[model samples]
Target chain A: MTKNILIAGFGGQGVLFTGKFIAYGALIEGKELSWLPSYGPEMRGGTCNCSVIVSDEPVGSPIVNEPDVLIAMNRPSLDKFEDAVVPGGDIYIDSSLVDREVRRTDVNVHYIPATRLSTERGFDGIANMILLGSVIKGSGVIKEETIPAAMSKVVSAKRQNLFDFNIRALALGAEVLE
Target chain B: MAEKVLMKGNEAIAEAAIAAGCRHYFGYPITPQTEIAAYMAKRMPKIGGVFLQAESEVSAVNMVIGAASAGVRVMTSSSSPGISLKSEGLSYMAGCDLPALIVNVQRGGPGLGGIQPSQSDYFQATRGGGHGDYHMLVLAPNSVQEMAQLTIQGFALAEKYRMPCMLLADGTMGQMMEPVELPDSAPEMAEKPWALTGTGLSRKHNIINSLSLTPDELERWNIDRYARYAKVEADEVMYEEYLTEDADVCVVGYGIAARVARNAVNAARAKGIKAGMFRPITLWPFPKAALNKLATTCRAFISVELSMGQLIEDVELAIRCSRPVTLCNRTGGMIPSPEQVLASIEEAAAKLN
Candidate 1:
């Protein structure tokens, strides 16, 4: 089945990087994928988002009109994209930033305090990865085992010391629900 | 030994150009296409290739002409407005019969338009953006993978015809990322016998001049160039046909618009409407004959684009209005959704009845 995923947050929230990691995981699993960002001026502030498609077949459109999974890292992102999730799809809301309840009944909603938990653990900049960890567990779109290697490939060598932190963040995210 | 790695479309084009033996890149920075220049700036130096950022788009195109005349594979990239600035240099390159690759990662257009994805440059790209009676072999890539593949093809075609070739992508294709298998080695470059590499005393000097003092001589040059363009048209038409067999409506588009149209075609089919898509991979050669052939079978045609019916005109001309040709388009940087295209397809299907 094809999975249309949308990840959105502020400009510095690693919205694009979160999408890239999932895209890389999809690639590692030999799935066809496309990652298209909200480019130009719209990428400046809290409205930044990216559309990702992971499919067994070739993707028709990189732009996701109604996503199967919506990862909203902020209140504005959740408000803007929550309704666009497909019926019976999944929506992950970063509860620390988004206090509003999900208004949809047809889909599953997981509210994780990604920012609060990450900051408590002293991993300030990788709340997106923590949310991504929940996304992997919540959606089952990709295997959890595939993420570390994908993260290794995506993170540059200069930042290699943060590799363990990112991996730990992913594990912490996965434990949010369990 | 092809290695698959995820890369943004602009970076893939830069790497693919290097793999195609392109040793020189000259371009000014522009939104949506700046990544191409950025990638070249970072990688070209390490590979011993020349990557010079010109003061303006005009100078960049002129630098391409200069480098290409020296018999090296050279390229430059820009967006819609910058492309307009480079038009004069493009016409000059065409007149001189130099080989160069020009990539237009098109954004909204006319003059200083927004940096959103747009196909507004369709007319400017295919119908000779530059002055004079010259044509550029325009390759339209819909995906990041095609962005890499077509850059290689663009360089080869430019060398083969001794003419400038364009990789006509848009902001969507430029910024998107996908897993692409890069070529293991640079393709073998064609020898340039008439190149203006220094003439040793043993050989006669070759002049690279577009200025023909005599009108008759210029006319002769134009005629010869037209003949070569005709050969390119006959041999290099590229397109992709999806579910065209026994379809009542054929949707035609290219670049990112084509990808959106493909989804519309599938959605239309799901609703029991006979729909298909004809994607022009080569926008200049246009795959007109293939489209014309489909017009005989399909009940009608819908030209989908991110411009105000730029490609539709060519679609009508190609089919000679034999089929009812209609347009489903969005202009000024708006991308039409699959539902929007489906509405048009359904409208076109209803018109047939």
Candidate 2:
């Protein structure tokens, strides 16, 4: 099965990082994947997005026109990409940042107050991972157990101290979904 | 097999170049391709290689010419505008018959254009961007793995033919991430007998130059270079054919466009449209013979690209216009989605019916 995922948010929102984590998770599972981010001038303190395609077969187009899953981290992102999700697809919204309700009735909408949840849990600035946890639980796109190894690859050697904290945040988000 | 690691395309190119024995890197930073320079900057010093960030693209290409003249593997990378600036040095390198790897991770074109990925530089790369009659061995990679593999191949082919070889990729290929297992062992470097090494009074002194005062000698040099290019054309043409046999329509594309077209091909097959894909791995040698052969069987062709219609012209010429070749493209940094390409293929198929 192929899953086309689109992650969107403002700069500094870990939009690209969130996509990378999912890509790494898929890679660890020995699945074929491609992760393409929206680069260039618009990324300078503006909106940023990433398109990640994870598949059992070799991936074809890296650009996701119609996403099977959309993770919107801000109001602008939710408004911009809400309609692009396929029918009966999934949309994960960070409700703390995006106050607007999704108007579409065709897709599955899961609203998690990711930013507020991250702050209340004393793990601020990790709302992306929290949302990712919910995404894994809701969509089952990747194995939840793969998050630790995937995080280890992406978190970098110098920032190893944040490893456990990130794991905690991911688990909390997953539990919130349950 | 070596362990596979997920890496961005630009980073993969830089790492593969190092593994392939490239020790000198000189370049000016450009968007979508700056990661290569950044990677080289971080790794070169530690590995005892030289990485110089030249003040401008012109200076950087000149530095590449200098390093290559010393019989060492050298490389320089840039985007569209920077490539235009390096054209002068490129022509000089070709004239001097210097072998080096020049990477153009192309962005939108005509001018500085934009930082988004584009294949508009197809004409510029395959036709030899600089002035005069010359051609660089151009390799177009579709995936991040090919981005690494082709960089290695580019260096070897450049040295084998005594000319510059260009890895003509787009910003998409530079920025995308995929799992790539790079080569474990270093590549075999060719002997450069024409290098400008100091004579120890045991061998004749070699001159590395492009300027010949006599018109006849300059003409002779041009002719000789063309002869060598013919040999490369005969030996180095590379392309990929997908589902072309027993098909009525052939889709041709290179680099990222080919990847997009492949998805369209599969969709077309599901709709029973009898469509296939022909991807040119080498833009200069162009796989003309293979495309021409496919034209004999396929009823029509669609040239999918990120440029207005640059690749379509080549598709027509390759098949000698025996079949109707249509352009399915987007320009100015915008890429055609798989749906757009599929629509074109369907239209072509309808016309045939």
Q: What is the TM-score of chain B alone in each candidate?
A: 0.99, 0.99
Clashing pairs in 1: none
lDDT tens digits, residues A73-136, model 1? 9998988988899999999989999989999899989999999998899989899989989999
Residue-level lDDT of model 2, residues B1-353, one tens digit each, is 48899999999999999999999999999998999999999999999999999999999999999999999999999999999999999999999999999999999978879888899999989899999889999999999999999999999999999899999999999999999999987768899888988888989899999989999999999999999999998999999999999889999999999999999999999998999999999999989899999998999999999998899999999999999999999988999999999999999999997
Give candidate 1's whole-model lDDT.
Answer: 0.91
Give DockQ for candidates 1 onward, in order: 0.89, 0.90
Docking class of 2: high
Q: What is the TM-score of each predicted model, taking all chains together?
A: 0.98, 0.98
Candidate 1 C-alpha lDDT tens digits along B145-193: 8999999989989999999999999999999999999887776788898
TM-score of chain A of each: 0.95, 0.95
List lDDT for all candidates, in order. 0.91, 0.93
- Clashing pairs for predicted structure model 2, backbone only: none
Candidate 2 Cα outliers beyond 4 Å, as residue runs: A43-45, A157-160
